[model samples]
Target: MIDYNYVLRNHILTHNQIGNASDKSNTQRCDVCGTFLSSAYALKAHLQLHSDNSKPYTCTLCDRRYSSVHSLRMHEQLHTGEKPFKCEICGKDFSLRATYKTHMFLHSGERPHKCVLCGKRFKLSSSLKMHIRTHTGEKPHNCDTCGKGFSTLGNLRRHQRIHTGEKPYKCTECGREFNQSNSLKAHMHIHTGENLPKYDISVIIYSLS
Candidate 1:
């Protein structure tokens, strides 16, 4: 006959040892999720679920993708009517971080994207892509209305707006109209007077130009 109490005590000690070992390891393989990741990254990603503070990457064209929840938050600026990034040339305001980064080249006169045909330099790759469409005569953005076509989806969407008059972006506070949701969200800040938390400050500064 085995000593059940002694076996239980040993099992408890073994569990504690395993727990301590897991705490010390920088990376671990999760048995439940079958994910192998660094403890810090895993913890940060895990914590994103508890609160609304986690996106770090955002797509300016659409509110469809987020690199991190922290990134999605900064993207809310587009809807809030906040233009932290300003352009010296036209005094234009940009809502997206990546757009601001692209705009910096205009002031610096740094044309990294060059045209092979005419050697024309552009500050942004997307601009270069659009310019190339002109040379290629390739209109990717097709309008369902009147079977029209455009080089950029933005142009096509704008054209479509003329027909539908549909503005999906709405401000929670004032019910303002916008093409993008980020703009509306940013507008709500005026009513709420909310500020970013300390932990998110670094992420905001890093993402914003």
Candidate 2:
């Protein structure tokens, strides 16, 4: 029911009366500490697809409903694709400040968040939280249909695609579709010929001779 693709598209404005990201009051950055917030927020919004409870805030342009005004303001950025945060090391642009800060750790080689159980390190605390679930056997998210459990809300949503049959990832070259982004990436190598293995058969034939 939620036309996610429609809401995400770049909309052309007819007039300059509408506000842009330049206005801090209109579009402020999301909280950096809410690592799982986007996923949890999306899952809750997805629930609204089956319920009568409308989201508190809706996009002025797209009319896509969101739980909060902060979320609504954040969604407005998608219309213009304006990334305020930029990485100095890699010259990469990010929509969220938290993601930009986390990316800096990759260049700095600083794994501040470490798993207390297995001693594995992570750049993001949310990743460490999900990793800890592996040792504790804690799967907080569950499927309503099959009752299958997943540690993170993201994994649960991806699994729900099995029931929903939603294949969002598409191959531009072959027109093939996949349920997951990684699957689409793997499929792309077939067109780019990146995954093929090279063998020096001439050397083997000469050596045998």
Candidate 3:
């Protein structure tokens, strides 16, 4: 007589053990990119970036090469100085349509990206992703020069100006320069006598009361 139930129980236990072992092994993460993969095959695919010989897509103008064709196309835009996508509202242009679409959100105030945890809305998915980091306390962007960490890449880029001493924004009025545009605008207010937009607050107060 065959003990079918006992045989099935053993088989299930063995399968669970194998799954647990596989999960534990998956904890081995890539040191270079910090990517975690479940299997050896996936890990090997990710580690291809560490290999210098595997960059198949090479840029003709620059020494930069990528493993994917899509990345190569994006890099080639810098060499060609191509601005194919144009905005209908502001007449501004972008090299990629995705960039132009994101820019359109600024004029439309159309915040489509919403946070799943906090119910907060953002104009862009990148903004939503950065907002999520506030809850997680994850500062992934780090400066190699100072070992300082920032929550967003924009903040990190601004911080790098301190090390590089780069003042990119300039005021046309006084020929004053600043590392950021907001600083230049604030300085401009000194000359322009606070060009703040006038608004009637009494109507809003009466409605609220």
Best by lDDT: 3
Q: For every model shown, what is its TM-score relative to the native structure?
A: 0.34, 0.47, 0.53
lDDT of 3: 0.71
Candidate 3 C-alpha lDDT tens digits along 1-209? 99875675444333222212235655547778765555566668778878877988889887798878988897788779899889988899898767888999899989998765567899888887788777655566789999887888899999999899899988788776777666665566667886633334542232223
Top TM-score hit: 3
List model 1 lDDT by residue over 1-209, tens digit each.
99875675444333222222245453554455443334555645655554434544556667556757667767677778787778767888888778887878767889898766457888888788788666655564567778786878887886686588787777665656765444445555557778634434433443232
Q: Which stretches of candidate 3 lie over 4 Å from their true place?
A: 1-55, 66-71, 143-146, 157-209
Report, for every candidate in turn, its global Cα lDDT versus the true structure.
Answer: 0.62, 0.66, 0.71
Q: Where in model 2 is the C-alpha error above 4 Å?
A: 1-103, 196-209
What C-alpha lDDT, on a 0 to 100 scale, does residue 68 get in candidate 3? 86
Where model 1 places Cα greater than 4 Å from the true spot, the runs are 1-63, 77-96, 153-209
Write candidate 2's Cα lDDT for 1-209 as tens digits. Answer: 98653443212111111212243333222243221212344445445554535676777788788877777767788787989999987899988677788999989999998765457999999888788677656576779989897889999999999999999998899787887776666666678877523335442232223
lDDT score for candidate 1 against the true structure:
0.62
Better of 1 and 3 by TM-score: 3
* Candidate 3 backbone clash number: 0
The stretch of ten residues in a row with the least summed lDDT in candidate 3 is 12-21
